[model samples]
Target: MTVDCAVIQRETPAPERPHRRTEGPVRTCVGCRKRELAVDLLRVVAVSNGNGHCALTVDQAGNLPGRGAWLHPDDRCLQAAFRRRAFGRALRITGSPDTSAVVEYVRAQTGAD
Candidate 1:
């Protein structure tokens, strides 16, 4: 289920254009391969401490500070992300948003389950 960060990174905005919005800031789902806007996607980031590491966390607030990746906010989008490993590939890490935790987060964030 692992996608490649290189691919997602290719589509992400260039460093100088962080705030600029392109007509097609679309990203693909590592799971279903759907093309969608990056913002429509939920941001996922990993949390780590001196303790070594923690589960992947879903950033519903879209404000988490580490290297982040995204997925469209939907059950299908979520399934795709997990099944395809978009987060792992996008963030270039082996771990990311905890599944059940992310589902719950998404439920609360979007008000659905």
Candidate 2:
């Protein structure tokens, strides 16, 4: 007499890995002190033309070389940053960097005067 046997098959589950952040780089807004993606905020850098003058220029293309400070394009944020002197602290500047250009740029981009 011959006995019949049955075999059972089982499937194994794969292990899960931690998800990586693929939404680009993250940076903090100097004005509001909020953490946001780098691409969403504007990049500004202190520029010196070697003429005993320095100014803060908005790096719309985000390709300027030097210490960069990030901020939102909102007037409120701008005011807050200015009030708190975040630009100087962030950029390690002794005197206040000319922010008119940056304000104008932000205004133009955000349509806020």
Candidate closest to the true structure, highest TM-score? 2
**lDDT of each residue in 1-113, candidate 1, tens digit only:** 99767743356666774564566577665556766788667677777644654567777786888887666667777777777777677777664544676777766766743
Which lDDT tens digits does candidate 2 get at residues 18-93? 9756599888899999988898898989998577667999998888888999998888888899999999999987
Which residue pairs collide in model 2, if any? none
Superposed model 2: Cα runs more than 4 Å off:
1-22
lDDT of each: 0.68, 0.87
> In model 1, how large is the Cα lDDT of residue 84?
71
List pairs with backbone clashes in candidate 1: 1-84, 1-85, 5-89, 31-80, 41-71, 56-96, 56-97, 56-98, 57-97
